[model samples]
Target: MVGFLGLFAHMAVIGVDTLFAVSSLVISNAITRQIKVGIPVWFCFAFGFAFTEWSNVRACWNDGKEGIIAGSAPVFPLLCIKLLLSWMTENKEAFATRTNAGDNTTITTSATSTSSTSQTGDARKAGGDINTNSKTGDTTKTGGEKKKRHLQLVKDNPDLEYVKEKAKEFYRKNGKWPGRPTLQRIAGCRENHARNALRELKGAS
Candidate 1:
């Protein structure tokens, strides 16, 4: 806990708007929304600055407080690296989710296109001119099929993936995954299913 708080204070002292500071804010917020719940970045920096300046007096330095004040410098680069690593891991998960969603959409669109093409051929055989009405109806039918497929995807969503995301969010806010009672509250899932989901998430597979 001390190291974490020190990291936040170190980030601010460097420069609140600097790249590392900004990245710290992003990484911190990804895990914690309420500054009160976590460390208040701006306030911590201000406090650290004030403390350092106050301790810089000749009397305080002679008392050996300067060594502690000077310790702040090294933490700056280390905290930046920590924040960047957290961001990279979170970004990877987010990107994977988007890729999965896009794949599902692509599959649905291709199905619609294939169904439309098949209907178009049938229309040409049955009439002097291809039946425009038939093509339109086929398009609508494929659209409904796509909707059903989308719903199915959600219903069949990998339980581990769903639970992992919720668990990560909960951990960010509270610094720990919920045990039995609170787990379902954060997950918004039924108790039995949540347990099953937990197994999948925790499983080797």
Candidate 2:
């Protein structure tokens, strides 16, 4: 070791070797980064060109698909066009269904609003206007039920028994219990409120 180090030529050679190794490592790192970026680019170009050539063959030679004949169109263009067309075709029905569902939701909201409005108008049932067969057509017999069934009903027909008496008077005057219109004018209870109370009484009996 001492004899080799003592030689001036040997010392210069060692320094040169160390410097070359470091330069080589730096170059290799730079080349590695370039290769990483270039590989994907090269692959894309190669695949695109190869597929284009293959498409040309299919267009000329007549690839054996069930519907297509040879030389109908350029193969590459046909593939691109069909790819987009098929995607639209696949989603068409789903889009239609979504549109219909939105319409249905709007219709349901409209119906709900209509029902609520009609309920307000229904608050005027005369006692005789009730139905025997319909459970909802029953009347509020006692004063408590007429007042307690619903807050809205209590507000409408504050005097439940007065309405009852009016219906009885109607029977004497007209020979029949007052029907829906008469009861509505007398008691001012909505159809639903009167009907629910009557039903409750009948069920309890």
Against the true structure, whose lDDT is highest?
1
Off by over 4 Å in 2: 1-81, 124-205
The ten-residue window of minimal lDDT in model 1 covers: 51-60
TM-score attained by model 2? 0.23
The runs of at least 3 residues in candidate 1 whose Cα sits more than 4 Å from the true structure, single-residue gaps closed, are 1-78, 128-205
lDDT of 2 by residue, 1-205 (tens): 2224457746654554444344434434434344233454445434544544444455456446532433334334534543555566668789899999999999999999998877755743433245543544344355556667554543366454656666667667887666665566556676654555444434554
Against the correct fold, how does model 1 do in TM-score? 0.25
> What 10-residue stretch in candidate 2 is worst by lDDT?
66-75
In order of listing, the candidates' clash counts read: 1, 14
